[model samples]
Target: MTGLDPELADATGKMLTQAVAEVVGDDPPVEVEESVVLGNAAEVLLERSCGAELLVVGSRGHGGFSGALLGSVGQHCVQHARCPVVVVRGSVS
Candidate 1:
């Protein structure tokens, strides 16, 4: 998540980048780049994804009914991203 708060955005970017790197591990590290923007998250992501091979986002489920499938930003990205968009939804056991 990016925008409004500089500290929050920086922390978020760092957290996400670190998480991705850890998930991929050092055996075959993945190439990752992060940008923090001060606008609509989905719009910024979509704009950035134009030159990307794929776009990945987590399902926040922030809108609609309580059990809604996707969040507003995720839904928008899936519909509009130029490249392939992957929405990862967390599962609770």
Candidate 2:
């Protein structure tokens, strides 16, 4: 969650988790972590990516050419990730 207020972020995160649980019926419990950041999201994702086994991200973020297969974030992570990276691209059905 990106918010100026940490309290608000925390509340929103909890609410989101609960809502996800409602939609994720019969699935095993999932672990979730929320970070309140005011900086670049790509940087934050990279910083937390040091020892991950796999880094999966969208092929394109909310920027640049809409027809491009990869965005700045995907390119940066693909180049900097310690492990393998997967960039998923799909049409909105």
Per residue, candidate 1 scores C-alpha lDDT tens digits across 1-93 of: 423577787787889778877666655455666566778788889998898988888887555663466777888888999999988866644
> How many clashes does the backbone of model 1 have?
0
Give each model's clash number.
0, 0
The TM-scores, one per candidate, come to 0.69, 0.58
Cα shift from native, residue 12, model 2 (Å): 5.2
**Whole-model lDDT, model 1:** 0.77
Candidate 2 Cα misplacement greater than 4 A, ranges: 1-3, 11-37, 61-67
Tell me the whole-model lDDT of each prediction, alpha carbons only: 0.77, 0.69
Please give the distance, in angstroms, between residue 68's alpha carbon in candidate 2 and its true position after superposition.
Answer: 1.8
Q: Which residue pairs clash in candidate 2?
A: none
Q: After superposition, how far is residue 36 of candidate 2 from its true place, in Å?
A: 5.1
Residue by residue across 1-93, what tens digits does model 2's lDDT show? Answer: 444687877776788678556645547465534344566867877887787666767775444665466888788888887778878775566
